[model samples]
Structures are given as structure tokens and as C-alpha cells.
Target: MKKIISIYILLSFSFAYPVTLNELIDLAEKNSPVLKEKALDIKIKEVKKKQIHKKKFGEIHLFGSFNRFEDPRILYPITPPIDPRNLVGAKNQFITGISYSVPIFTGFEIEKNTEISILAKRVKEIEYLLTKNQLIYNIKSIYLKILSLQKQKKALISYKQSLIELYKNIQESVKVGKKPEVDLLKVDYQIESVEAEIEKVKNSIYALKSALKTIIGKKDINLSVIEDVRLTELDNFNRTQLLKNINSLDTLKQATLSEEISEKKVKIAQGKYLPKIYFTASAQRNMGNSEYKDLWQVGFIVEYTFFDFGRRKHEYIQSKLELKKAKLQKKTLRLKIIQKIDEALSEIKTAISKIKASEKQLLFAKEVEKIEKAKYEEGVSDLYDYLLAKSQRFLAESSYYQAIYEKESAISYLQYILEEFKNE
Candidate 1:
């Protein structure tokens, strides 16, 4: 009977739990409109690349026409000897033919332009990943915040329980003339104060949870267990290593590809100054006497745009400038990433120190409370000392959670700058 009851309790606990972080991320990825837009951009660039390739593949034209004119010859009265009206009288005609042109070369611009679309697609993919990374960072921040509130709620409940028990004891003593009635009143007021604080913390937890639900596209997120690490983990952080990590992101990779694409653009632009060569073939059949016939011809055609008033020169210069700009942007981004890493590490250190000091103060306060309780029971201690001890403990616990949450925030910030938590 005992084993069955225990199993039932476990099942109930499982069913009542909130959704996890990974599940929320999965749902967001599936439904996020922003990500969908990025994916479509890739498709669009891919199609453009196909068009660029077709520039090399050549063009094929298949055309047909039919006419039955009522006015066979709208002839102006003219002289004999093949009069101009003879040309007009041949009005009823049918035409059908297939003509094709295959490009043999295009100054190598077709191949070079194709790289531009490829790079554009890559840049779009990187932006999408960066957006998703930002979302995950935000989600984790809220996630840890809810956990912090949970810890706070637990601490407040513990403090409130102790206050209530002490209050009950004082009330009994007052009834028996062993304690002052005013003392009972004082403890009762403290109880009310603690309850108010607990209510405030609860409300904050709800707000944070609500925001988190909107992010992960879900309403039921469980923040019961928040994994918090000590701040000492960042004491030996290497700035060089972190900067290297930032460059490892897909965004940085896209930046490099953009430079390469720009180089290709310059090549394509220079190609404009050269001549493009192509081969050609054409066939035509005409029937005016109700007789079928065929005519065929094949030859090579070369087209060279030899000059364009310095347009190609200006274009090549623009492409080179763009490539330089991309490199500068990459350098600026690296500097910013380095700054973020240093600041986050500093924050982690400060939180750790504060937490340690708070821990010591809490221990001292616990000892003071023990002494004050004994004196109060003997009627030698006043209400002030007791209230002060209780307040000290509450404040200490609150600070402890605050430090924890700050450390969590720092860790998350570092993870984002490093792209550690973001999927490639």
C-alpha cells in the first residue's frame, strides 16, 4: 500500500510540471515568422544564381504567326511593271520557326556574378542565426530570473513560518501574564510585513514567467530548478581566446565571404571593359505558293563592349571600396566583442565577492538571533533586537539570491558574445 501511494505521488508531480527550455526553443523555431523570412531569402538568392547561369546557357526562341486578311490588297491605283500594290497583295501568310543562340563566352562575368548571389544567401543565413541567438539569450535571462524568484519565495516562506511560531508563543505568554501584550502586537506586525514582501516577490515571478512564455511561444514554463554556478568560474578567462571564439561565429564567416564576393564583383565589373564572344545559329522557312521548304544557317557571333565612358572603372572602384568596408566592420565587431567579454567577467567577480560577504554576515546574524531569542524568553530582551535579527536574515537571503541571479546574467552574457549557446 505504501509503495503504490508513493508511485501515485510521483506521477502527479510529473504531470503538474511546466515545459522545459529546449521544448520552448523548438516551438519558437518552428513558428517564428522572422526565421521563415530568412529561409525564403535563401531561396530567392538561389533562383537568382540560376538566372545568372542561364546567361551562359544561351537563349531559344520558338515563334509562329498566322494571318487571313479580308483586304487582300488595299492598293492605291498605280502603274504597271511590278507596281507597289504587288507587295501589299501578298497579305495572307503563315510563319513558324525555331531560333536558338548559345553563348560561348561573356568575358567571364557570368561565372563571377553567380558568386554574388551565393554570398548574399550566406549573409542572410548568418543574420537569421544571429537573430535566433539573441532570442535564446533573452530566454535564458528570463529563465534564470524566474528561478531566482522561486528561491526568494522559499526563503520568505521559511522566515514567515519562524515568525508565526514565535508570535504564537508570545500570545500564549501574554494570556498567562508572562509576557507583555505590546510584545505580541509587535511580532504580529512583523508577520504582516513579511507576508507583504512574499506577495511582492510572487507577483514579480508571475510577470517574469509571463514574459518568458511569450518568448518561447508557450505559457507553461517550469522554473522550479535553476542551475546556478559559482562566479569563480570566470576568474581565469582569456581575452584572446574569447575574441577568437567570436570570429568563429557564422556571422563572422559571412563577413569574410562578403569580402570574397566583393572581389568577384570587381572582377565582373572589369569584365565590362573586355569583349564577350558567343556562337549563333538561325533557320527560317517561308511558303507563299503552298509549298513547304527549309532554310538553315550556322555561324559564330562575337560581341565586345569595348568602351562605356569610364563606367566600368567607376564600378570596379566601388567594389574595391565595399570590400574594404566589410573588413573594417569585421574589425569593429571584434573590438566590441572583446569589451563585452571583459565587462562580463568583471561583473562575475564582483558578484562572487558580495555573495561571500553576505554569507558571513548571515551567519553572524543567526548567532545574534539565537541569543536574542533566549533573552526575550527570560524577559530581558526588547522587541527591537528580535526584529532587527529577523530583518537581517531576510535581507541576507534576498541578497544571496540577488548575487546568484547576477552571476547567471553574467554567464549568459558571456555565452552570447562567444556564441557558445547558439547553434551553428
Candidate 2:
């Protein structure tokens, strides 16, 4: 019976429990409408690539036409019949046919188009990954912020409890004519102030959680986020290796794909200077009042536009300019990515220093508060000193939690910049 009850309790906890950062990110990816849209874009690009590929094989069409003439004419070309009655002529005729046209050559236009489509698909895939990475980063940052707030709230509650005890002690001292009634009132005011701050923190937490729900596409606003201390531990990345691996980032990959696509466009434009060749074949039956004739033909066609008022030349130049622009953009993006990496690393270090400083400050504040508490109770100090010490302690505790979470947030951002969340 005890085992069954334990299983039931575990099941209940599994159904509704604090989700870890990774679990939240997974939920956001699975439910986020933005991610869904990006996923659909990938599929659309895939279909587009296939469409461009099929174009190389050409198209087949079924065509029908009707015509009326003022004078009777032969429905189709035929040998003259010996009997005049056997001649097939009509004022109205109908022809129905199926025709196939395939591009034999367009100076590599088809090949270039196929290549562009492939590059486009790759770009879409990278874009999807970029979107997912961004979502994960957002979830991590918000989760850290929420955890920080909760810790601050807990510290505030502790502060309030201490104040309440001090208030009761001062009340008794005032009754015994050892302390002023104003001391009790002062502690009362401080308690009220701390309570207000706690309420503010509560509201802020609610707002952050609401935002989290929106991002994760969840209807439940009562979300409990778990803090994994391991996430705060930084990995020592080789700065040189990180710099060298920047090219593998999704942003750079996207830019590179764009440049390649532009190059393909330039090639396609250059192809326009050459003649286009096609293979055509058709089979048809012409129907008249008295006869029906079947006809079929196969042929190759070559079309050359030697002069188009320099249109092809202008297009080729334009494509070349675009390719140059793409190259410039890629260079700019590379520099920016490097700058961002530097900034994130610097932030991580700064947060680490702050965490250390705040940790020491909190320890000092706790000792000062304890000393002041004893002094105030023994009449060695006044209420003001005790209140100040408690306030300082609360601030130090809040700062410590803030610094810790800030480091976590910075690390999450660095991981995002590095595309570390792509696989997840």
C-alpha cells in the first residue's frame, strides 16, 4: 500500500512540476508558432528546389483549337483523292493535340537555376536553426531572470520575518519603559516597506511568467522554473578555437549561402547572352465533317537574340553588382559576429567578478546584522542601527542572487552567439 501511494505521489509530481531550462526550451520549440512558421518555410524551399529540378525535364501540355473559315478548306494536308466525293473539306475544323517541349540548352541557365534553388533551400534550413536558437536563448534568459526574482523574494521574506521579531521585542521593551514607543513604530514602518517590495517582486514575477507563457505558446501561466546550478558553471573555451569556428555559426552560414546564390544569379544572367535551344514534339488529330487526319512531328529549335538593346548586358552587370554587395555584407557580418563574441565573453567575466564581490558583501552584512541585533536588544545600540543593518543585508542578498543570475544569462547569450543550442 505504501509503495502504491508513493507511486501515485511521484506520478502527480511528474504531471506538474518545475520544468528545467532544457525542458522549457523543448516545449518552446515544439509549441512556438514562430518555429512552426520557419519549419514550414524549410518545406516550401524543399518543394521549390524540386520544382526547379523538374524544369530541366520540360513540360507536356494537351491543347485543342477550333476554327471557322469563310470558304471550305482541306482539314489537313493530304494526298488528293481520285474520287471528288472522297475529298475532305470543311468550313469548320477542330484540332486536338499533346505537345512536349524540353530545353536542350540555355547556356547553363537550367543548371544555375537548380543550383540557386539548392542554395535557397540551404539558407532556409539555416534560418530555421537560427530561429530555434533564438527561442532557446530567450527561454534561458527569462528563466534565469525569474529564478533571480524568486530568490530575491525569498530573501525579502526572511528580512520581513526578522523585522517582525524585532518589532515584538521593541514592543515589550516599550511596555517595560526601557525603549521608546517610536522604536516600535519605526520597525513597523520598515516591515510595511519590505512587504511592499515583496509585493512588487511578486507582480514582476507574474509579468515575466506571462511573457514566458507567450513565448512558449502555453496557456498555463503557473509555471515553475527549476534552476540547475550546473548551468552557471562556465566552460573554459579556447579563445583562439572559438574565433576560428565562427564561420560555422548559423548567421555566417546564411550569409555564405546568400553569396553563393548571388553568384549563381550572375551566372544565370551571363547565360542570357547565348542562344537558347529546345526540343519539341507533338501528335495531333484534325477533324472535319467527312474525315479525320492524324499528324505527328519532332523537331529541334534554336533561338538567338543577338541584339536586345544591351538588356542582357545590363542584367549581367546588375547581377555582378549584387554579388559584390553580398560579399560585402558577408564581410560586415563576420566582423560583427566577432565583436559580439568579445562582448559576451567580457560580460561573463564581469558578472563573475560581481558575484564574488556580492558574496563577500553578503557575508559581511549578515555579521553586521547579527551584531546589531544583539546590541539593540541589550540597549547598546538604537533601532536605527539595527534597521540599517537588516536593510543592508537584504540588499546584499538580492545583489548576490542578481549577480549569479546575470552570469547565467550572459553565458546563455554567449552560447546563443556561438550557436551552441543548434543541436538541442
Candidate 3:
């Protein structure tokens, strides 16, 4: 454990590229196009929720029309002996009225609407969080790759230095008739091969950084050196507890409210068949082009739709189907969430085992290289054997970093599963 901590400190001092997880998550949220669009949707839904919050409000309607003498208000006579009461005027009719109408009863549109509004909000929120989780995964994955590359690079450089010293000793021995020239050539070839590999890995690291910059929305972000980082060394996290807190993803219960609302919409459609009670109290000033006079009228309307093709039936069936669809979708999401959790847990177990194995391999390689160095100088080992041991150590070191990266990536998967990435 101390060795691990020391490795982190050494890397931090050598290369101070410090970007915390929180900063990465913030950058992603601030710059993501998808999250921004989801935010807009949330705002629009919120506005709708606020506007329709009042279940019952009076309806104020006003209308005016401009007409020529060709079509006058009195052009057509009223109904039943052309009574004035039956005539709806069309000449500059400026009729304004406030009709006070309470739900008196809606097929329950108010209740359904309230539930749907809340569910809509949840859906948008989940979309935003899902965006956040994806961003976190992308950023952290890239970040881990960068660190892994740096660790491998450092190990290669260290191994190269060790081989340089050992080769010089071997050369001195060969000149003194203690070692073979062939062994010297072998060391040179080993050095060249390892150097090529290091270059290839460096290119890979560069590509990973480029991908990360694009995700962060940087036009031209330069990647500097990244220090080795050991993530929080905490006790084993509770997957159960984490998933329990992630129940927000299960907004299906709330989504089902839409079905309830649809049920209410069906009632509302049926209500269209029942008589509606509306109180209409209005004061209007009537005027004509010739000697205009003011006339005031007030009344209440008890209106009912007497006959229509099966329009109400169509509306009820459409609403019922919509409700059924929402319920089915909610159920599907529940199963999806469980599958996601199971996959993450499997990855986590694999990563943990890999990390443990990497730790032992790294330790063994270090000891092997140290022994080979001492032996080569004492003429107990040939130059070729010495260089091979050095290269092997570097390989082991790189593998250690690969294991570290895999561990972090697995943890990221778990975080996504549990929705802790939103906190990031």
C-alpha cells in the first residue's frame, strides 16, 4: 500500500496535471449539446405545468369583424319569425365575456394533468442525468488511459536507464575477456525494440487525449502531462445502497400517472356528451353607424352537444391506447435498469481481480530486474539475458497500469449504474 501511495506521489511531483472528477463532470455538463437540449425541455414542461396548474379558471372570449355593406349584421333574418334574439351579428361584433366555469366536473382532466405534468418533469430530469452519466464515462475512461500511458512511459525510461548501466558493464567485461561481443549486440537490439514500443504507446496516448478534448467541447485543448492518480482508497462500496438511491430512474410509477390521466381524458371525452354548466355574465355596449346606442346583456349558458358522429368514441379509444403504451414502456425500463446493474457488478468483480494480480506481477518484475542487474555486472549473466529482464520489467509495469485503468473504468461503470455520476 505504501509503495502504491509513493508511486502516486512521485508521479504527482513530476507531472502536475490536476483535473478532479468533479471538474470533468462540470465541464461535460456545461458543454454538452444533449444536456442543454434536455434543460430546455425541462423549462418548457415547467412552463406548461405552471400555466395549467389552475384546474378551473374563467374563460374570457372577445371577437370583432370588419364587413362591407354587402354583408351586414341584419342581412339575414333571425330564427322563428326572424326574432332579434336568434341573430348572431357579423358587423363589427366586439363581444367580450368572462364565463366562470369550474370543473363542476371534468372526466378528471385536472387530476390526470397534474400527474402527467409531474411525470414529464421526471422524464426530462432522467434524460439530463443519463447524459451526465455518459459524459462521466467518456471523460473518466480517457483520463484513465492517459494516466496508464504515463505510468508505462515512466517505467520504460527507468528500465532503459538500468539496461544502459548493465550494457556498459558487459562491454567492459567483454574487452577484459570476461563477456562475449554477441551479448553486447543483443542488448543494443533489445533497447531499440523497447524504444519503438514506447513510441507506439505514446501515439496511442495522444489519440486518447484528442478524443477526450473533443468530448469536453474544447476546440484545441492541449494535453499536458498527467500525474499518476490513485482513486479514493475507500472500503468496498455498497452496491445495494447505491442502487437504492438510484430509484429516481424508476419514474415508471410516475409515468403510469399518464395512463390515469388518459383515463380522465376518456371521461372528459365522454363528458362532452353530458350537458355543461357555465355561468356567462357579460355587459356589452352596442353601437351602429347610424345613431349608435349602448345595449347591455347578461346571461348564463347551459350548453350540451346533442349529436355528433362517434367523435367521442374515437377520442376515448385513442386516450386508452396511449395510457396502455405508457404503462408498458415504464415496465420495460424497470427490467432494463436491473440488467444494467448486473452487468456493472460483473465488470467490477473482474477489474478487482485484475488489479490484485497486477500488483503482484509488478512487484515480481521489479525484483527480477534488480537481481539481473547485479548478476550481469559480476559476470554471472550475459548482456542478452540482462536486457531481456529489463524489457520484461517494463512490460510488467505497463501491465500494471493497464490493470489500474481497467479498475477505474469498471468503477465508472458502477457509478453510472448507481447514478452517482450525477453527483460528479
- Note the Cα lDDT for every prediction shown: 0.76, 0.88, 0.68
What would you estimate as the lDDT of candidate 1?
A: 0.76
Instruction: Rank candidates by lDDT, best first.
Output: 2, 1, 3
Estimated TM-score for each candidate = 0.77, 0.90, 0.71
lDDT of model 1 at residue 355? 77
Taking the tens digit of each residue's C-alpha lDDT, what string does model 1 give over 58-135? 898887766666665331234467655354343465567788888777777888887777787778778778878887
Better of 2 and 3 by lDDT: 2
Q: How many backbone clashes does candidate 2 have?
A: 0
lDDT of 2 at 195: 98
Candidate 2 regions exceeding 4 Å error are 1-16, 78-87, 225-228, 235-237
What is the C-alpha lDDT profile of model 2 across 1-424, one tens digit per residue? 9999999978876776666777778788889999999999989988988998999899999999999999988877666456667668989999999999999999899899889988998999989989888988888788888999999999999999988988887788889899999998899999999999999999998888888889999876447546554655654556788899997788998999999999989999988888999999999999988579999999999999978998989999999999999999999999998998898888888999999999999999999999998998788998899899999999999999999889888888889999888779
lDDT of 1 at 353: 84
Clashing pairs in 2: none
Which model is ahead, 1 or 3, in terms of lDDT?
1
Full ranking by TM-score: 2, 1, 3
